[model samples]
Target: MNTNTNTNAIAAARQAHSTRCRQRVLTALEQAAHSGDEITVSAIARRARVDRSFLYRHRDLHAAVLVKAAEPATASTGGPSASRPSLIADLANAHDRITRLSHENTQLRQRLSEHLGEQAWRESGLCPPDDIDRLQRRVTELEQHTAEQRRQLAERDDELDATRATNRELMTRLNRPHPDGA
Candidate 1:
């Protein structure tokens, strides 16, 4: 009976219309999925006459809707078979994609294993390979350093021996040659 209540009802109807517009956009997306053809979001927004960002922000919901929509329709013949070639084609395509991605995943895992092996080598600081090499470069360097130190030690021992021998010769000469002076 009041014009004020009529205005509020009109506003409520407009809001409901906007909500339905957004829902219709989602419906269009669900219908287009599994064809392997690109579904342009802009086209959806244009068809719904709604803002595109709202659809983008709720993309997970959109994806869920598409998945639900793509579910196999009930087989009137009580089994899934040659009766539904279109559905079968879509399922076959999905199967192929799953297999291909699985193969790629294995290859990636192998490469990651190789990368980890290289990292372990770098971290351990072990002599780089060639345990049976002709010249064993790292071991050769260690052996050369050891030989140099041994040579120096032998020379020092020789000098000590020569000092002892001279001391003994001087003592013999002193004891024997003093008879002439007496």
Candidate 2:
């Protein structure tokens, strides 16, 4: 019987505490609405001196906060405007777009300038007409010819070395004493 009574008392205390928290949340929301302050869960929780989870834990309080937050601020307290964080995000996005466009504009100007410069240079008649394909073919031919000359030079060097070796052998044989002891 004592345990049952104690349980009942504990339940009542918990209910009272929950009721107080709910009241505090409602009062805080009302104050915020009147003051035209942003009605976010965190702000309400701070103003109510309750944990954010407390608001979430109570569905009624949570819904109330959502409803209040969605309502536009009255004209008396600085007409409806975007939240600070959202405004900053929008500003950042605009800056990024500006930077991207600036870079694109710079690239376009450079290409245009280069094209105009090339046109002017051509019109000045200072640059001779260039046959790029013919020049490329000539360069390839020269490279092939140089490779062939190098190969030929290497073959001549090998032949010269062989000839020198034969000459040395002949000299050694002529200078040697006759095999018959003459």
Task: Please give the CA lDDT of all the candidate structures.
Answer: 0.70, 0.89
- Which residue runs of candidate 2 sit more than 4 Å off their true CA positions? 1-84, 171-177
Every model's TM-score: 0.27, 0.48
Cα lDDT of candidate 1 equals 0.70
Candidate 1 Cα deviation (angstroms), residue 39: 3.5
Candidate topping lDDT: 2
Residues 34-56, candidate 2: write the lDDT tens digits: 87787899999999999999998
lDDT of 1 by residue, 13-67 (tens): 9879867876787676655443323345665566566777766767764565445
Query: For candidate 1, which ten residues in a row score worst on lDDT?
Result: 30-39
Model 2 TM-score, 2 decimals? 0.48
